[model samples]
Target: MTTHDPIPARLAALRTTPTPELKQQWRELFDSEPPPFNRRFLESRLAYRIQELVYGGLKPETIRRLERLGEELDGGDRKKSRIRADLKPIVGTRLIREWQGVEQLVTVTQDGFEWQGRPYQSLSAIARAITGTRWNGWVFFGLKNHRRTA
Candidate 1:
């Protein structure tokens, strides 16, 4: 049951195979219907599942060590570590936007955002103040984009 070649070959083949063939491979390997995810998701998960079968999954101790490394890199605090690294703006970074023909500037401080020499808790607040309406700060400043529809 520990065949390495066909598993990787199948995983690789998944990239070029049509959806029906991918589902067939899913049935053969997992003995269940594949989730209705896109081709990339199916291929990546199936590749990992194939590898998991051929070589046993990661050891618990190894997983713990990796988690510890991640925590250490993310400022050693669990709360900070929980924040997505991409979402955090580096200290001293300046954000600028134009609203109503006026340019607004915000500076990223160690604790929060500084706008017009005033400390604010969240970007949405700044966006609301600038636009005189409710707006998602991240979206307004382009930190985050709206999710794409399938």
Candidate 2:
């Protein structure tokens, strides 16, 4: 015996499928609309992931602001969410690499990814091309600035 339900109800029921199937479905859902919200979420997730990898003592204020922004957005506040819209790496994440070496020194705070000794124009530009890969990793290996440097 088959029972028919309203279209909305049927669609909602079919939407979830199951956990395993939901994985692919979820991918499609994100891929279809990887925009401001999704991009921010992904970037936040990537930031946290990279933080875990490097174990750098990121600025507490920075972390707090990011968390607050994410929370506000997840709560459905589009305005606040838009503030974090710039987080997404449109191309991909990059590591600060030296101009002539495989080793990455660390990013300089001048708005570009820094490598061994030279700074790149931007993360996306450095990566050249982007893939759906969760950001590779990052190191807090910043330059040592003496009082004189400042």
Name the lDDT of candidate 1: 0.85
- Clash count per candidate: 0, 6
Encode model 1's per-residue lDDT on 31-148: one tens digit a residue: 9999988889888877887888888899999999999898667657888777766676988999999888999999988677999999998889999999889998998998887775
Per-residue lDDT tens digits for candidate 2, residues 9-78, read 5335443455444444335544443333433344444444334444555689999998887776557566
Q: Which of the numbered candidates is closest to the native, going by highest lDDT?
A: 1
- Estimated TM-score for each candidate: 0.62, 0.20
RMSD of each: 4.8, 17.3
**lDDT (C-alpha, whole model) for all candidates:** 0.85, 0.45
lDDT of 2 at 145: 28
Predict model 2's lDDT versus the native.
0.45
Q: What local lDDT does model 2 show for residue 138?
A: 29
